[model samples]
Target chain A: DAGITQSPRHKVTETGTPVTLRCHQTENHRYMYWYRQDPGHGLRLIHYSYGVKDTDKGEVSDGYSVSRSKTEDFLLTLESATSSQTSVYFCAISEAGENQPQHFGDGTRLSIL
Target chain B: AQSVAQPEDQVNVAEGNPLTVKCTYSVSGNPYLFWYVQYPNRGLQFLLKYITGDNLVKGSYGFEAEFNKSQTSFHLKKPSALVSDSALYFCAVRRPRGNQFYFGTGTSLTVIP
Candidate 1:
């Protein structure tokens, strides 16, 4: 919970279409992250933002892009959806303090047809 | 690169009995470890973490984890198991100054009544 919300809890898109998932937060946490969860894969980070307009790629950043122009909003986009890109996506926010645990949103389920 | 291992894929326990979900991690130098839980159709929620200080770390829902440097393990334990404890558990590890966490495949725990 933790004041985090993921828009379009479920979504379906064509393989060649572009899809974007939005994450909103009420808390003004300095760090936000995008992660995808799949069976046998656990959670893999796609991208993360340390501050407004600052972003970095994670281990699974391929085929995904993210942007955060504001502190409370983070967006993840799949430029061209693929069957392999279908997964449950989660957004998390973390405090600026060191070693603090991250809070997560419910998640968005994406399906590519 | 950081990695975490959840040795068991599933663990079953009767209600009121003690429960444990094992986790082990690998990282260079000292590391930061974390635990998260996910219910069906939901994202992960923070349980607890091993940052520094004592090896035994207490978390939410009457859960706790022990950080063993020599063993490279952080196992989650609960004195009593509840039916509601049936869910997926994840263990994660990160470097001291790292921004992203590496997660394990996950373990499914079922608490029977």
Candidate 2:
């Protein structure tokens, strides 16, 4: 296990509501990423942070925003929840190098009604 | 664009029989390959990775992968299968010096008792 924790294991909310998921890592890795997993889509990257306050958009960054204020905490926010945003979210951390394998948190299951 | 592909959506093998999951990648420059397994309702677990050196890479849970650069494939294989080995397997690829990783849709493996 990689000392990674994801808060709010499960949540169900109505459309147009705001939703935020948190990912905390004990390991002081230099990179953190947020991804959504759906049936047949595998895992799609939403956003990533290379360092404190340094972030970049991923392939599917639309409708989602992320902030990394500190080295250990990364937050993913959905300004307005939509039914299409319902999916299992996962957070992963890796060392600075490209060859390093990523360590993942359990994940957050979110559903929009 | 850099990408990974798992040709099979599902694979089934009887207990004690040899099992294999196929993975092929397309990336510019030297690519880093990795395999991960995910149990139901859990995060992705690192299995094995091929960064450099030998073509055969051994990973967790008695699994090994063969990296064939000529074929542009990294296939996961186990000598014998177990019922507990059933899970979703994903293949990923990352380009050299790149921070982002592209993953496959995932292959569901079912090892029957």
Instruction: Give lDDT per model, in order.
Output: 0.92, 0.96
Per-residue CA lDDT of model 2 for B17-40, tens digit only, reads 999999999999989999999999
Candidate 2 overall lDDT versus native: 0.96
True contacts recovered per prediction:
0.67, 0.79
Predicted complex 1: CAPRI docking category: medium
lDDT tens string, model 1, B1-113? 57889999999999999999999888897888899999998878999999999999999999999989999999999999999999999998878787877889999999999
TM-score of each: 0.97, 0.99
The best candidate in terms of DockQ: 2
* TM-score of candidate 2 against the unseen true structure: 0.99
> Where in model 1 is the C-alpha error above 4 Å?
none
**Model 2 C-alpha lDDT per residue in residues A35-87, reported as the tens digit of each score:** 99999999999999999999999999999999999999999999999999999
